[model samples]
Target: MVCSEFAGCNEAMQGVIRYNPFSNVGFIEAMDQAMSLTPEDKERRMMLTYEHITKSSMTQWIDGFLTDLKHSFNPGQTSYYLGINFSKKAKHKKVNRLMQVRQGFKKLNIENCSTSLLRSNKCAIIIEIESLPNVKFSRHSVPTADVIETIHGLLIDKRNTIIIVGKQTRETLLNWFGRTHSFNGNELWFAAESGYLYKAGIKENWQKLTELENVSWIPQARKIMEAYVNNIDGAFIEERQSCISFNYKNADQEHGTMFIHDLYNLLDKSLKGTNTEIIYGNGFLEAKASTVRKEKLIELLLSKLTTSSKLDYLFYLGNDSSDEPVYELLKSERAKNMFFESHSNKFICSLEKKPSEADFYLEDVDSVRSILEKFYNNTKKKKKIRSFADLTKITNSIAIESQRLKKGTVNASSIANLNQ
Candidate 1:
């Protein structure tokens, strides 16, 4: 049963194959793979998907969003704020502290220590896909094959590499990479969309969607959105089975706001008492059926991961609000106990000056590449992989370094800001 990309149909049934229509070759390949799966295998996948959808409800999605929204803003201010929430005086204090640390880092002989530190640890890296320089919006509208090859190098390494991204974006990357043909549909595991959907791609399961009754309002909603787009010069409609978006990024703020207000009023009155959800971001207005969230997707991934392997270190890096749920979860005692206690759990930001739950900051995408390259080099040189116990020694040495710096025993070497 090959399923449409979105529609409440994904939520209503279990054990359906999923496909992204944007990639013609990939879509056809997925269909071909589905035909070869055994009936028992299909049943097992279906049961699992059913169990998942039943456990993760629409209400959970709404609650998760509200909770994340609350935590996203600065402590005092209520409106949307993305940068570090420092006051004028606090900013000065922070800058001074950063300067002190920068000096301390420079004084520390880290060049000799870098390889040894990373070589000892078994690392699991959860890097956001869009954070890389090659994938930046301005550089490549879609990821090139070269970018995917770089990512594949990281993935095929000894370390556990997780690329966190939205489902739509992941689909595009997979198409470009020519790796979409998977028998079990476990090719892209860490997407913001439900992992179960990816797993369900083993079989063509569109029949499962047709079994469920259609939402009568979906077509009408599309029509209403099209009408709005037709009237507004810069406003354009993006239609999906699960959502409709009116994008006005090129429009002036005044005109965009007015159109949003008019559309919101119309939708509000027309779709009142229905299950439709309205959400606004940057220069886009969206209405969709609330089914799942990024946090829930990550949570499932974590659970599934435990059955496979144990890691000594975990690093999660992301740049947007969608990444907040996983960040917030890791901040909790439960997630800490489950994943962080025995491991060196570090959350990093790809860029500095961004407000995040990250413990450390990398300057930008270049730093990311540098760090990964360093790690790869270290790993490639090693004759044997180090154990967790051996890894602790490296961490202990870093601790000693910290103490020495605090006691002012180390001389400040020349300040060479290598940024990595």
Candidate 2:
């Protein structure tokens, strides 16, 4: 029997066939599945509508035009970029309250709701929260301590650096080191979902947190500080995610795409011996009942964790594929509160939609980039024209195009008009 999720009545998505794969009910179904949103899915249909237009060839041309425009990278403070979707999701007065933490900004790997920004004197770290479940998952087979330490060292060069974790990993971090975490409303609905905030592990009283669900759950600063304490003590606090879920599937016209750059960088580090603490491997089916001994490998990895004195949001992103038995194991362990040996902190972020909770749904990989563009446009700030290099120093097509213009290679169009 076909089951409905969130709000079971999808009249707009009523079964209908079409000729072009993109125009068929299957395509719509795929979009609906991929979004993985909830009863309010219809309210946020624009997420996909906007995506369809963005996936259009014209959108790519625009993206290319902008990207061709240079780049630089300086390790900066981290911030967890999440999404609340719309302004009305919750009452406005609660925005600050919802962003509250029991303690001030500290570390990540120990929170109820993942923090968007964490600050501390020990080291300033940033984190960006993302969720891309479609990509193939692997155990980050390239686990190495020397590499991990070296990367950590580079971030600490300035004392305060940023790190990022996706929803899937957020829950994992919460489990590894008991703590509470959360992001703001706008932060919840960001498109690129790229930002990093350093999070420290810490302990908390779950019973107390539940009581303050409406009031200030905790102050942001205190949360980060608590996170730091947890990082140092290795005693994480516990909490669970709200009830509800969303789901979106891929259509034949398009295959899902994740930030190749993100995965590639991680893989590069692993292969280059820069990040040896993490490892990746063969498919999950390889283990029918037995895949690579995940527990033992994790055991070896956990041993490495002990040597790193302070807590940091060390995260791993995974998706469905035989290569990701570890991802499944992590998911399973999180539910059982068996993240790492001696790990008692427990929390849930609902990386996978449980039903009735997701509000912003989407399909089409282009939609991700597209939705982000709109969000960016909607909140257009009149800051000085930032060079592509200036926009996070990460390579962007817009920056490339801007460079071409600088060298008289392209037409003179305002950066403001790139989206138009």
Please report the candidate that would top TM-score against the real structure: 1
Best by lDDT: 1
TM-score of 2: 0.21
lDDT of 2 by residue, 1-420 (tens): 122321212212222111212224545676566456564664456454444344446565466435433111212422221222111222321111022112222222322212211221122222112232223322222213332233233332232222333222243443322223322111111101011111222222111111112212213222322322332222222222311001112111121112112222223333342211122111110101111233333333333333444333223322222213433444464523432333222121222221111111233223333332332232222111233324654446568778888898888665446634
| Model 2 spans with C-alpha error above 4 angstroms | 1-117, 120-291, 308-316, 321-351, 354-420
The deviation in Å at residue 29 for candidate 1 is 50
> What overall lDDT goes with each candidate model?
0.51, 0.28
lDDT of 2: 0.28
Q: What TM-score fits each model?
A: 0.49, 0.21
| RMSD (CA, Å), each prediction | 21.5, 27.6
Clashes of 2: 119
